[model samples]
Target: MGLLSVRNRFIEKLRNFATLSDPAEAALEAATRNASKLPARRDLIREGDRPGPVFVVLDGWACRYKILPNGGRQILAYLMPGDCCDLHIGLLAEMDHGIQTITPAQVATISGGEMDSLLTDHRGFARAMYITQLVDEGTMRAWITSMGRRTSKERASHLLCELYLRARNIGLTDGIELVLPLSQIMLADSLGMTPVHLNRVLKELRLSGTIQLRRGSVAIVDPARLAQIAGFDENYLHRRLRPAIAG
Candidate 1:
């Protein structure tokens, strides 16, 4: 009773879900309905709302942010394709932040009605979605560690390297270059630094011969040296991607 035609597109994506029996086929079928696809900088969802199915980030970068008491927006996290965006909130009673696009994006919103149906009908799907949120929680812990313990320069480099690897694995990056639309201001917000400080760190990386960043292109002159300086570990992402139903 689902869209049976576009099964091929879901394989690579659902392979990371672990609970998907036939990732390529079942996941494609599950993605039957897409309401509206909009460009970035639009609000996809907001805070203080009820839980829903999930937004399967089909493409582009989005960030969850909350307005602080001081009238500043505190960016919580960045969501990529395969990320559940608000999976944690969906399981809970309320939303804490608003999810908005950062780039010209493509997002498919899974319907709440369909989710209600899944909880009643598809145990496998329900369980998978729950675990996916847990996976999300683990990543939050890692982000916190990176921000609190690591230096600002390392934090900035770490986040960039993380995005590069994620994009590369999904065929978005070729390892040499990353297409990032984020401004230094946004980078400062995400890394908990000021624009002036971020520029200094970026300059340090450039002077050290580790990275060349301009416009949308980011080239790691020394990938290993960059990783060493950033203290990045891709274990959280890669281990999550290891095929559950291996061939």
Candidate 2:
């Protein structure tokens, strides 16, 4: 399929995630016009570089993150379909983080010049993109609290719960049975714990029958129990319930 076709399909998927007014849709279509697609594992954009064109994840998942001196990585965010990977660039003094693929993905690049043009022409587009930035900031604050205050067990479960919420927003999860791609070691880095410690906590969660992870798939055996263990809360995502969509 062509870039426009991919964009149209992504737009359809996004309607389930957020209310994109018609003008917003037009603005997005403009940015996507004459775009190029990227295969998975390609560095669509990197940290510490001038903000280039925004990337639309036509399919699959990507992560935005930063690496510490010892090579530890903190995944700041995951971008799914209907989400813009560099929408926050306009607000940043410089790029301080990097993005990479987690799953096989098809991506479309929209030039910064076109984004600037759309901001002037598409009021709703500007509003939606700005809202995306605000949403990211709020989630970052939650991560700070989770990593700093929550227990290692809480930290992992919280991340799982959070991904569940995000995956739902992207119409990927059905409110449960979400898949987390990162291994236990990756989980440790994001939660600021040693891999050994993270593995220990995972064992505890599994033994308690609150959750289970096998073959890279996570099954919430007892969501309420799991929530209790990790102090998971849906409020952090700030997403509209799927059932709330209008007829």
lDDT of each: 0.69, 0.69
lDDT of candidate 1 at residue 110, scale 0 to 100: 64
Instruction: Determine which window of 10 residues in candidate 1 has minimal summed lDDT.
Output: 1-10
Clashing residue pairs found in predicted model 1: none
The sequence of per-residue lDDT tens digits that candidate 1 reaches over residues 131-201 is 56776677677779887899987888888888788777666766687877788888888778889999999
| Deviation in Å, model 2, residue 60 alpha carbon | 1.3
* Best TM-score among the predictions, by candidate number: 1
TM-score of each: 0.83, 0.82
